[model samples]
Target chain A: MSTALLHTGTHENQTSLAKKKLLPYWLLAPGIIWLTIFFLVPIYQLISTSTQTQGYGIGTYVQTYRFANFMDAITSSKAQLFRSFEYAFLATCFALIISYPLAYAVAFKSGRWKNTLLVLIVAPFFCSFLLRTVAWEQILGEQGFVIKTLRFLHIMGAQGHLTATPFAVVAGLTYNFLPFMTLPLYASLERIDIRMMEASGDLYANALTTFRRVTVPLSMPGVVAGTLLTFIPAAGDYINAELLGNPGTKMIGNVIEARYLAIVDYPGAAALSLILMVTILILVMAYVKRAGTDELV
Target chain B: MVDASSSAHGDLILKNLTKTFGEFVAVDDLDLVIPEGSFFALLGPSGCGKTTTLRMVAGLEEPTSGTIFIGKSEITYEKPYKRPVNTVFQNYALFPHLSIYENIAFGLRRRGVKDVDDQVQKALDLVELTHLASRKPNQLSGGQQQRIALARAIVNRPALLLLDEPLGALDLKLRRAMQIELKWIQTEVGITFVHVTHDQEEAMTMADTIAVMNEGKIEQMGSPADLYDNPQTSFVANFLGQSNLIKGSIVDSSGESAVVDVFGTKIGLPVLRNHAHDSSVLVGIRPEKIRIAPAGTQMNGNILEGGVISDASYIGVSTQYQVEMPWGQELMVFEQNDDGTPPLSKGDSVVLSWSPIFTFGLAGDQDVNAGSEAHPESE
Candidate 1:
């Protein structure tokens, strides 16, 4: 009789346990189904398309498993690939250099004006992205004051112009994504207790030493997050290169865009797109790991 | 365990130190002298200027009009890093990114010390945290991090170490253990330490001299026993410990003794010991100093009769009673539970008695509860 009672208790517990275990999966069903349909299925299609070969007609392809398409795309457009990384790296560095002090001021010194200053930092976003890029075009144009000042200072050659140059492209990238860099840095710096800085001074460190030893290291998480936010999108950007840069400064993004649309090369575009996506994923994984900010990943 | 007369090289003297934020005064015309190698405590409820005074000494805050001297060098205008003082912040402010070893070595490295490892290792050993030398500060428990903060400040060997509620973040058990450990460390190092805390027990346990502050001024400054036995202000009486203050007026004054009348009874006060401002005075007595007995018992010295027990609480080592006197004032009395008498219940008529020598006098013109009012924690 005791064995029978124990068996009944176990049977009841098993039913409840099964129901409890199914609750989380049932809650997760909507998100999982959405991602599978909208994200994973497209990625699968892209992978399959990347291995296809060009067909006899325009806008057509065959499932030939032409893995060599990726190699061909890389060899042909290696300069653009390298330039994309170079421009992105330089822009990220400039954004960081410019944002650190601004973020610090907003975080620590703005006092009653902190909110107003933050709004000012984000005010440019009210305009469309393309409109902002076009605005930069006018500012850096040959007829604009910036170009005139460069000429007056003899910083540029007699016939030199600011627009349609590598400098303009990088500048536009820096300006467009600056808030992305500033906000995270402001968040991290704001979280630093002022007591820590005072304690640093109490420990015989001068102001500069305190900044180097304490302020910079404590804000590394913000630095990692800001750099990723700026660099990842900047690397794949094509608009700046198209409008502000000359042909010599073209990036892999411009090539992939032209291959897909202007050149009508679907297989080549798919392979190039796949290579870009995979390379970014690998680089991001390695960077986050190296930064020791695993929580960001 | 701290002595005020020894180690004459590291004394701190402050004169007319004042700090004001806009129209509000934070530290008002404060004057102090901390003897060399003495563990002095600036004890007070919050907003009493103890921390402001400490900050002025550390050069973190500039005094409006004052002179600060460390063994005779006027350092009022010196920058914080230039001052020969360090502070252990209230939150333990350990650098989150640095290991325990590096955090301790920071000062040495900044000053370009040649042998950092030895100094850092010695400090680690001083705090008994050599085992955690390789761990980052965030990886350690609050108690261990507190020790690291101490080690970090002490490793610099500054002339004065200002600790701003360093144990305020720890659990009760850890705080008690650290109090003894801090006292031991002060003795071991023999460095002049100026500690600021709101905890009366912590100050009494660790300080050689405590300056009880109220309203940005020193209410009383003396050794622990002296302050407890003879508090000059009602603020000091209530802030340091619980006091049963009886409202009274001086009936007679003489060379060595004065008589104060409370209700219908005349209680004698020690003239030299009392600090009464006028005929109006508040007679004060600590709870433990008063003895309670059955209503008809004979009493000598100072006595209060016809008090009914209002409340009784059994607290293991002692029984605390709230007695309602005939004058409609409730007085607290603590009786030792040594004789194993039956516990007194509420409504039992009792007589309270204590020696006249234990009574103190404070100016009654002031609010009896002025400095003793309970305030939420202020920074």
Candidate 2:
């Protein structure tokens, strides 16, 4: 009887231990289920549709497994794809150049006003992104103070227009994504021991060299994060090209939008979307490899 | 330009150095000359302006109204980068991104010096961390990182190496080891090291000359033995080590010894050790200097009578006795265990005696408890 009781007790202990072991999986269930329904399911549907061919009737698609649609989409919208990357790359570089100094000033030099300055860096998020872009449009418009002042100072010719140009599109992207760059830069720069900069100075590095060798290199994690955050969204963006850019400044996102809404080409749109996603993945991986975040931690 | 060969190697002199942060003065009209190649220490409690003085010397902080010279060249207005001074910061501020090799090579490379490999390798070997050259700073332990920080600065071969509490983060055993190593390194490199630390033992272990700072002024500056044996101020007497101060007044001054009256008990103090501004003085004695014996037993030196052992604690190496004298002042006595005398217990009547040369007198008006506790910086 004692042997049987011991066996039963061991069995119960094993079952309870099993429950404890499964707790983490049960906790992860909600996230896994949500992703399966919302993200994974959509991806599967997108992949299946990208290979489909048009049916005999309008608004219909047949799964013909025609991989040629990807090539067709790429050939037609290749310019837009390259333009998107170029604009995004330029916008990311501009945002980084503008944000790093702003972040450094706020982090080290602000002292008592640090919190106020940080709030200012992030305060623009309270206004709608579209509204801020529209404000920029007015500021750079022909009759706006910026253009008039530049024309008066002879910095710009009388025929020079700020709106509907590649410059305007890149500027809009940079302005919209600035906070994304600045916040991370501020976090990393603020976390730097101020003494490190002092040590650099003591070690015979001038102010500019210290910034380049010590300050810039030490803030690499923030730089990488900021660049990715700005570049990713900017690459797939269509709003700036639509509102502030000329027809020549059209990006791949605009082409995808046109393919789906204006032309009713679902397969082609799906193929283009998959191509854009893959291209960004490859570029990001290559960039991360070359940027070398091995020492970031 | 700081010609490292000539201008950097001479005495570093600070003339009328004063730094004020608005309403409060951090370092007030301080003048000091740290002799060339000496391992000098600015020893003080936290915020006693020791670090501020060091920073002024390093060109990190601009003095309010002072001129600094590395032998005749005025460096007060010079930028930090232009000065031939490098600092091993308190926190070992190694560049987190750089490997140990690159960190040591930084100063050498910044000066546009070619072939930094030999110097970097020598520095890594000097710190005895040649194996850790390829690893990043975070991977190293606190002690290792500290050595790297030292290596990073010394690779530049700066004339002055300022160590700002470089061992403050280490455990006691490691801190002790680092103290000896730092002293050895200073001697080997022959740099005029201006070390700043609140730790008295660390300062005493390494510094050839120590400047004990208190509240924006030097309380006393002397060799370690001189400061410990002949402190001129109550702050120095209590801060350097433990001191048993008894209120006394000078009764007679005639030969080599001056007689002091402490609550009707006559005590002998050396005439030269008297630093009191007036006849009123606080007689100070170190705890270990005093010997304790049962009452009525014979004792030599300046003797105190009619005292009872109120407290006796037997630590491994020594016995500590707190004797309540007839005057109601409890005098501390530390007896080494090497003496074969039977251990005295609490409540036993005892006599405290020490050589009169150990008795130093300070100004009576100074606070007796000034340096017992850690004073808040700047307050």
Candidate 3:
């Protein structure tokens, strides 16, 4: 009887322990289901479409398993893909340069005005994203105040127009994604204890040395987050190119959009989209590994 | 290796140094002279301007007026990096990204030291953290990080080393261990150390000279023993340890001693030691200085009769008694638990007595309860 009771007790303990171990997985089920339905399924469908051959009807494609479509799509539009990365890289660098000082000011120097400054950093996000991009076109127009001032200062020639140039496109991309760069940098910089700076000074490091050695390294996590946030969306963005850029500066995103919506080439668009997605994943993984912030991942 | 030139560094002097934040005075016209190669402490409660003073000396906060001289050089307006002073901040403030080795070498590298391997290794050895040299600060415990902060500053062989509550974050047991370790390091290096802390025991244990500050002013400055045994202010008497101050009026005064009356009892006070400016004074005696005896015992000076032990706590080393006097004032007395005598219990009849030498007289014109602010029990 005692042996039977012990057996039953052991069985109950094992079941309860199993429940405790599975509790976390049960909690994670909702997120996993959401990702599978919303993200994974669409990606799978896109991948399958990327391998499909062209069909006879407009906007209709058959799954013939033609993997050569990816190679053909990449070879045909390699310039646009390269240009897209170039613009995104330039925009990310420019955003970093501009946002770091702004973030630093908001984090350390604003003092009593910190809340006001942070709100202003995020103020652009409250407006419609497309509306803000359209506003940039007008701002960079030849007749606008900004161009007029540049003309007066001889920075731009009388015949020069910024409306449909690569400069205007990159400028618009930079302006549109600035908040993404700034907020993460601000969060990371703000988390740093001010005593660390004082300790640096106390340890006989000058202002510049301290900033380079202590402040910059400590804020790298934020820099990484901000750069990724800005670059990913900016690389995949075609709206700025459509509105502010000419045919010579067209990016891969614009090509993909044209193939899918304007020309009704589903297989070609899906192939380009898949290529862009894989290339970005590889680059992001490499960058994250080089940055040595697996904890952030 | 010791640098002979660094050892020859002179004293740190502050003359009429004041720091004001708009309408509020953080550090009032403070003047202090810290002798060379001495361990000095600025002890006070929070918001007492001890930190403000240390910051002014470190060149972190610019002083509103006056001059600061390290040795003979007037570093009043000098930049922090240019000054040959270093600090161990309250939170250790070790670089989160840098390894223990790099953190120790940071100051030396910044000052253009090309070869720092030996110095960094020496510092790691000094802190007994050589094995953890490759680990970042976050990987170390609080005590280890604190020692790293110290090693980082001292590796530069700065003329003056400032410590702003360096052990404030450690647990009690770890803090006690670090205190001895820090004191040993300071002596081994023989650098002038200025430590700021609100902990009395931490200060008393580490510093050769202690300055008790309150409200942006120094109440008393002396050796720990001098400050404790001969506190001139009521604030010092109660703040340092615990004091039983009794109100009294001086009846007769001689060269060195004065006769005073408390309730119905008479006591002799050392006039030379007292800084009283009025006829009325408060006689101060430490709790441990007062002896507890059975009621009706023949006692000499400063004896209170007809007192009952209102409360008694046997705290291992000593038995504390709160004796309620005839005049309704409670006087605390500590009797050492020696000779295995049976401890005193509450409500027992007792007499409180002490020698005249232990009695300090403060100006009675001041508040009798000036330093009687409720202090949190020390850990």
lDDT of 1 at A196: 78
Error at A119, model 1, angstroms: 1.5
Tens digit of per-residue lDDT, candidate 3, span B1-379: 2222343369999999888999988778888999999999999888789999999888899999989998888888887877888899988888888888988988887776756899899988998989999987888888888888899998898889999988889999998998899899999999999999988889999999999988888999999999999988888888788988888889889657898888867888998877789788888899888888888878776787899999999899999889999989898888999968799799889888888898899888776666557342443
Give the lDDT of residue B324 in candidate 1.
96
Output the lDDT of residue B360, model 2. Answer: 95
Tell me how many residue pairs clash in candidate 1. Answer: 0
Tens digits of per-residue lDDT for model 2, A1-297 = 999999999999999999999999999999999999999999999999999998988869999999999999999999999999999999999999999999999988998999999888889999998888888888889889989999999999999999999999999999999999999998988888888889888888889999999889889888988999999999999988888898999999999999899998999999999999999999999989999977676
| Predicted structure 2, TM vs. truth | 0.94
- The DockQ leader among the candidates is 2
Docking class of 1: medium
Which candidate, 2 or 3, would have the higher TM-score against the true structure?
2
Worst 10 residues of 2 chain A by lDDT: A288-297
lDDT of 1 by residue, B1-379 (tens): 1111222256799898899988889888888899989999999888888888889888888888989998977889887877778789888888877888998998778767778899899999999989999988888899999999999988877788899998999988999999999999999998899999998889999999999988788989999999999999888888888888889999998757789999989888889767888999999999999989989999888998999999999999999999999989999999999987877889999988999899999988767776566422222
Q: Candidate 3: global Cα-lDDT?
A: 0.88
Q: Candidate 1 DockQ score?
A: 0.51
Give every candidate's TM-score on chain A. 0.90, 0.93, 0.91
Off by over 4 Å in 1: A1-20, A151-158, A294-297, B1-9, B375-379
Q: Please identify model 3 stretches exceeding 4 Å from their true place.
A: A1-29, A152-155, A294-297, B1-8, B374-379
Question: Considering only N, C-alpha and C atoms within 3 Å, which residue pairs clash in candidate 2?
Answer: none
